[model samples]
Target: MKIFRKLRLQELLYNKKDKRLATAIKLMVGRKPLNLSLFKLAVKHSSAAEETKHGIKVSNERLEYLGDAVLGTIVAEHLFIKFPYRDEGFLTETRSRIVNRESLNQVGKKIGLEKIVESDLTEKGFFTHKSIYGDTLEALVGAVYLDRGYYFCRKFVLSRIISPHFDLDNIINTTINFKSKIIEWSQKENREVDFLLKSITGSQRFKEFTVELKIDQEFFTEGKGPTKKKAEQEAAKNACEKLKLAI
Candidate 1:
């Protein structure tokens, strides 16, 4: 019985290191990865980066950088073709709406990317920064580009990632001025709308802002963002939801 148990343990260990794991990851993105090492590096956060013999640190940061450019280009091309009648400003604004960090995080979550990310935040549970998922998704895109080239990466991104999750038509038609919407709703309902900049944390390069929305002198909802404007907008968005105002 002891020998049987030992064999089972060894099987588990071998399975953990199996290439099938890499193949499974590829299946998630709807494509097989030619170089699994790139995908492995893509999911590795800076906190888990290892030093190589060449005196260089390897992490997903560079991949994320490359993926950001690739994603921007793909998204720009998509927007250009989809909205040929629209002006440059409209195209740019719409593209920003689509490729924003929060949107990408949502997409990443939908694709189960969060389940595979190797990060310090994994042990922290829900307290981790939201940007990690988005960053990892971008890194995966970079890996796909390196492994499969531009055309394949673009197709995978559009078909598996963007097309399934985003409705570009709805996105184009939707207005996102949550603050103004909240204010207008408040005026109609005779409720006082107030936004308070509660606190600012972190250094200049990476500051986080907290904002709270109060309705009729009562706390409605609070939100946090990298900038005061964004924090207020988030707070207002929450307020809008709480009040059941369709945005």
Candidate 2:
């Protein structure tokens, strides 16, 4: 605890939002972080380090690679020892789902790492930037592994991410398209939604559509997507998110 208090850089990197995470890491690691640069790089987006040459300035990507390998090996070993009856095929798929980019991004967002990230990107970077959040999350895991070890990394992941949020029973029945679910909920409540498609512009796979949802043309929620239907879905989703406003 004293060592962690000594690391002013840790305090700087993680602000009030990461309180639980900080406490969890401190308790699980049993030792404060000594290497602050590794943690800094973990939360740093590649765009922020574009001036430095690739494979030289040390973006989190390289650390992500190492972390991915380490996580895979550790998970495989754990599953192997824990579930002696489980087959290799099942283990592989399970590990894949657990370590997928989308899953990591969800955890990263829930933990508020997005706010603490050091990135030079703009609003356009959200969807346009490929795997920034995912990469940053992986780098963070890598940093934890380096700063502490397998035990702490495993403990922190299980506690902060798996136990607190990743409920196996609930997740199985959960709706993946939350935006669409929001719209359906709104419709059931007798709320009318109107989605207006403004534009569709971009090359093939990179195309984007701008849309806005009008609740009686007063309550509006804007969204963008690759197609008109998708854009409308996003707008409806946004509208659903705003239903608590009591308008």
Clashes of each: 0, 0
Q: Candidate 1, overall lDDT?
A: 0.82
Q: Identify the runs in model 2 with alpha carbons over 4 angstroms from their true place.
A: 1-31, 50-55, 169-247
Model 2, poorest ten-residue lDDT window?
Answer: 238-247
Tens-place lDDT per residue, model 1, 76-175, is 9999998789899898878877787778877888888866777764656444565678888899989999988999999988998789989988998887
Tens-digit lDDT string for candidate 2 (1-247):
5476565555666666455445544553345556656766676677786444445664577788877776677656656775688788766756655666667677777776776677877788765664566677677778888877878888766666556756654543443463566667657777666667778889987999999776656647888888787787767655654553211
- The whole-model lDDT of each prediction reads 0.82, 0.66
Candidate 1 residue-wise lDDT at 219:
91
* CA RMSD of each candidate after superposition: 11.6, 11.7
| TM-scores for every candidate against the unseen true structure | 0.65, 0.55
Clashing residue pairs found in predicted model 2: none
Global Cα lDDT for candidate 2: 0.66
